[model samples]
Target: MKATILLFASARETVGAPSLTVELDENSTVGGLRSALARACPALIPLLPFLRIAIDSEYARNDQQIIPHDAELAVIPPVSGGSSLEIPAPP
Candidate 1:
């Protein structure tokens, strides 16, 4: 199956492309895509470990299978969401 993966943030900067279309196995997983992506874009190998795979805007696990459908795939870079505020416990 062939799918197009969108890139964002650091991932976009790393590849220098907004998106990529690659052929993958029908039962490919997020981890598998990482491998194929590394081959397609050698520069991304280092970032693969840190990048997160999103299917339809939702985070996907490495072992999660890439469903054969019109799902939006995105390579999301680590985002710093700022430190959390302290919350006091109530009795």
Candidate 2:
């Protein structure tokens, strides 16, 4: 099965690409795909826990099975909400 993985923000910089198309097993799990990515790019392992995955625009669990020939593998990192709180600058 062929799938396209869309990377965002840090994930894109970590993998050095905005997107990647790869072949995966028809019954591959999200976790499995993550592991495969780690194997391919060791730099991503540390950020795996911080990353979120969505399939077909819906958030998916790590163990969620990937559907073959589908178009919604997007990697989303935690997004920041605007806040008025300010931190003190180093003196």
Candidate 3:
């Protein structure tokens, strides 16, 4: 089965691409995809644990099965805070 993986943030930087096409088994799970990704992109190995796999816009679990044809897969990296909250002055 062929599937497309969308990479984001650090994941994209690591793989040096916004997306990639991979061949996986019909019954491949999220964990299986991670392993295959690690094999294909060694740079992603260390970051895999911190990344989340989303299938069709929903976050998928490790054991969740992936349907290649109907799935829209994405590798979401850990997110960090941007700015500090400000306190408003009493009028």
Judged by lDDT against the true structure, how good is candidate 2?
A: 0.77
> lDDT tens string, model 1, 1-91?
8889999777788779999888888889999988889988998877777789999989999999988568899998777576222221332
* Candidate 2 Cα misplacement greater than 4 A, ranges: 82-91
User: Rank order by TM-score, top first?
Assistant: 1, 3, 2
TM-score between candidate 2 and the true structure? 0.79
- Local error of candidate 1 at residue 43 (angstroms): 0.1
Error of 1 at 39 (Å): 0.7
Tens-place lDDT digits, model 3, residues 29-88: 999899889988998877777789999999999999997567799997866566222222
- Please write out the lDDT profile of model 2 over residues 15-66, one tens digit for every residue: 8899866667888999888877777678877777777888988888998898
Q: Over 4 Å off in model 1, which ranges?
A: 82-91
For each candidate, give its TM-score against the true structure.
0.84, 0.79, 0.84
